[model samples]
Target: MDFNLGTCFYILANYKGYRMSVEECEIELRDYDGEFLRRDVKTEGSIQPEHEVRENCKGCKRKIKLMDEGCVFGCCRVCCSGITKKISSFIGGKVRCCDVHNDRIIKKPTKSVKKPIKKEYVKRICIYKSLSQIIYTGHGADELLAGYGRHRTAYLKGGYKEVTKVLKNEVGRLWERNLGRDDRCISSGGKEARFIFLEDGFVEFIQSLDVTFIADFELGQGVGDKRILRRYAEELGLKECGNLVKRAMQFGSRIGKVVGGEKGDEEFEKSEKFKPPTTDPTKYDKDYRFDITLPDWLPYLQTHGYCVISSAVSSQNTNLALKSLITSLKLLHGNDVDTWDIPEHGLISETLGQSSGAWLIRGSSIVKSAFERIWEEKDLIVSMDCVIIWLSWLNNSNFKPRSEGLHLDQNPFNKLDMISVQGMIPLIDVTEEIGGLQIIPGSHVGVLKEEFKDMHGDMRGKGDWCQAKEEYVEGRGGEARLVECKAGDLILWDSRTVHGGKVGSLGGRREGVEDGEIARASVTVAMVPRAWASEEVLEERKEGFRIGATFNHSPHETGTSTGTVKGKLYEDYIPIELTAEQRELL
Candidate 1:
């Protein structure tokens, strides 16, 4: 951190907004200026330019006016006149939090927050211990209006295959398109900028108008796209900003892009580590016990049903317990919620024969009812277990379970944490969408339980789609963003974290009939006890924690996604190019 200005900023945050001193600024200015100055390296000696110092040092430059010897801070010697003043004023003033990122120009990385306090509303004085508030620019025109390629694309693509290919590519492009731009654009004003996009793939080779960009559900093929969002953006008050093709994210302050660029050659779907068909995902379970990944507190999800497993319990014991649980409530014991329960908790009782039964159990089988209920939703919510179970039971609707094993919470019935057994708590599985579970990073921190509206206090105060119903999430400024991951990669999120489905493909004939059913395939999981578990598992399972994210979660109005499956294996069907070594070994 080098500073490049004549006057440095001394941010003494007091109640009367932030305060600074003339002397302090004078002293710190040198350091600040040093941060912006470029230096020349020499063994014997060398003569560099004067004005040549303007450009930040790449190697060596003809001009070296700013500073010959580099300062402690890696300075860029950019000599824009008022640039320093703006930097000084920004650093010097008392800033209020905004729904945007404000650290774009600062040396520090600014985090996004729920909302921004306007200058008039800010307190004049703050305490000495207070830190400078960071801010971001609003989402700009995109915040209010949408600009997906409308009907125009339909005309460009010659046929179904061509259109389908573009559709697939669109979703993948999001990772690259939003990377640098979102963080940079919003934070410049010390405000936050964020948006959501769901697509069957990419769109925009279209460019429609009186038409929309994203398709709505009724449109089927056209609906899977984000045309609806563009329409929503316009209704909200955002304007179309020119041709609005996606802009590269690297243009702004997001450091991740500088550290890492898109590895287009690699396949994202593969990171999900989807398995091939006929493979008993459990067969590879040499160390862990469950079909899913293990947590640090407990390597194997060995069925202790009770908190403590007898030291003697073997892998067979855990397997038998899992099998028995499946026997009790075929879908529930599997730890996946099938369909919306309405008052939603009823299924818990239905599964464990717990009190939730009335709310969830439809008839002989909760699984059957779950599907029928999902058939009602215009929008689908999906997770991993939903995919697995849908496939497992696709051929056998008649195989209804008599009951689920006793809820470990009750004995003879006291078997498991009722929450864990029932899967009422949020458990994250990255496969729900190829992008991994979406989250509002740091949205969890800096919020008081009282101020928090939903499970997570929203930073943007924009939308609620991730948590509440369409009306609720949008009403509260709830936001979402996809976190990309590799297959087999285990991502641990807070139980309250909110996420939704990203549809890949759909089609299920009710009875080998042909195509009457539309299924949204995904995976799922449940949280269990073991205080030492959450923290321990993440460190042991993942290579490293790339970002420190405090998630936002809402318990009320929270609903789970529907599940569906295709006979096709995740590995064979995805457009992935495996490593050469993998092929040779195969």
Candidate 2:
């Protein structure tokens, strides 16, 4: 309390014949232990009456408690403290529900702002996304792969017959059992829910398995939850992951851990703000975005089934690839889109399809590294049937693609296992505004390969090459995003990924040229590991290089030659001074 000016003055005035100055008398009055000081120091009078302490809740203080613990310590069971009440009971306290509180913490539907797109160094984020985005839940895995403890129990008692019965029951009820809850949890993070294990191909693979191979008495006891999955994991060098037993997510993430089982009221008193249970890792916030770089390319490709690397090849090399195409087509100028006309018999189409060796000149260390990382080896072979230059906006007519939207490279004629990946390096920017290759994100894993495997036997001699399922096409209808990139950016995709050339609009036509204006140009080179190709194929490729002939463009098409092709010589067009790793690819 501040000293009153008038009181200080009066005390100074009372300081008569003593040699004390006015300031000194004021100081004495301030230090004096008089009635006011004694009143300020009195602790006895400050304590509230005992009756007042028993009147209200310790938290909100509106309700009355007649000596009952919950009524006094915890607030009225309504809006403010129910989360705390739920937490308390979860930890082992006998939660007595009133009209307002429930026995279990009810999941309240909460609305939030749209979550932003997450970008990260692909591998680092893959683990996080694997858990958080489209989870590969162990729901169906348990039944299909014999992953449950109970499955082991049933097997030990009744053998494979019992095991298959259990599996059939679980598999049949998969949609009813997990979809609703999983959707709720996954949607909380602003991600659409999808499960890899429940896809039809994986389900069929499990169903087709002989019970003996899946669960044998000789193979040693118990329902092997995820037995097949664990074996695959072990084969992939994830022995620890293979051995790790399954636990419910609620327990694994500590969401079900009780707070005050033996600690008593002191534990309850410690929680002040009522922190909610969360599964997201503390190391990174939900909104954190990762700046992608060169090192992230391979992991991104593997995880997402696609990635774009900017400046993967020099502009000169990219331009040379375009130049080779121009020379092969017998066009007047590389710069003039008007001159890039197709012949009446579609000779240009033939040239565009088989200009494979021409694109080998564009290969650089960066491109080679990306390929090596993809196939996981240096021994690689350029796809003989790619190198197409899409004059998407040509002749001022909106190009309508003949094939129905997105398609996979794997047709019915080829086995599902014979998949090839391709890379498209644009000489110009392929933007969404100006149409280009449209790819479905994550289709390589979720849809493509699985669909291929599912279509295997039925599609063989049907003569209908496109094996795309109706559900897949419809489900991912709006998800086919344009593979946008700048000049020299390389867009890579798995062969099985759902992708196709997007027909460009007349709006993409150049301002100056009212007719035949092409806005984008790209050079796509199909690549597979050299190890995958036979000696005959390699010999044919080498012979093509020696004789200056173009090989067949696609596996579906046969090879044809325009007698003595005119262009830059084969050696000049292809890389001559190659590194040992580069030579391995050639």
Best candidate (score: TM-score): 2
Q: How far is candidate 1 from the true structure (C-alpha RMSD, Å)?
A: 24.0
Worst 10 residues of 1 by lDDT: 1-10
lDDT tens string, model 2, 92-186? 33333322243435443122212211111000000011223333445566667666645654654466788778878887886775666555444
Against the true structure, what is every candidate's RMSD? 24.0, 28.9
Span of ten consecutive residues with least summed lDDT in model 2: 120-129
lDDT values of the candidates? 0.26, 0.48
TM-score of each: 0.20, 0.41
Q: Candidate 2: where are CA atoms >4 Å away?
A: 1-293, 331-357, 360-362, 392-395, 398-404, 411-419, 447-457, 460-472, 510-517, 546-584
In terms of lDDT, the best-performing candidate is: 2
